[model samples]
Target: MEMQNITLSLPKPILHRVKILAVQRQSSVSRLLTQAVEKMLEEETEYEMARRRQMALLAKGFNLGFRKPASRDEIHER
Candidate 1:
């Protein structure tokens, strides 16, 4: 894949912590951030797909197996 470099700015404290985390993980900060962003996008895509499927199911509706509507009296029968 082709990659383009971009500049980013972060607070000193956060950058310091991220550097420590990168060392602990044996990875560079750039790689760590890339993985995190990729994971976030993947989750967002999955959630959107699930939401569309559920919405389609709702739009299609369901069959309750009733030939005719029941009267309120029948429903409230003693």
Candidate 2:
């Protein structure tokens, strides 16, 4: 994978906290930032997929609510 470098500025207080975290974890600030970004991206992708699935099903008039036991079993069988 290609790598790019960019500069970011953090508030003095936040940067101080990051330094403590980096020392505890024995990781560099950049590494911690990268890991944080990766985790957030994974969650975002999951949210997007779920949203699309909901839209598609709702387009077919599926109400995302509880139903009586009989109606629930009927939909599951199909």
Q: For every model shown, what is its TM-score relative to the native structure?
A: 0.78, 0.74
lDDT (10s digit) by residue, model 2, range 1-78 = 676899999999999999899999999988899889999999999999999999988888856696666767787895
- Candidate 2 residue runs with Cα over 4 Å from true position: 63-78
> In candidate 1, where is summed lDDT lowest over 10 consecutive residues?
62-71
Q: After best superposition, candidate 2 residue 58: deviation in angstroms?
A: 0.6
| Backbone clashes, each candidate | 0, 0
Highest lDDT: which candidate?
1
Model 1, span 1-78: residue lDDT tens: 888899999999999999999999999999999998999999999999999999999999999786877789988999
List lDDT for all candidates, in order: 0.95, 0.90
Candidate 2 weakest lDDT stretch, 10 residues: 62-71
Task: List RMSD in Å for every model shown.
Answer: 4.1, 9.8
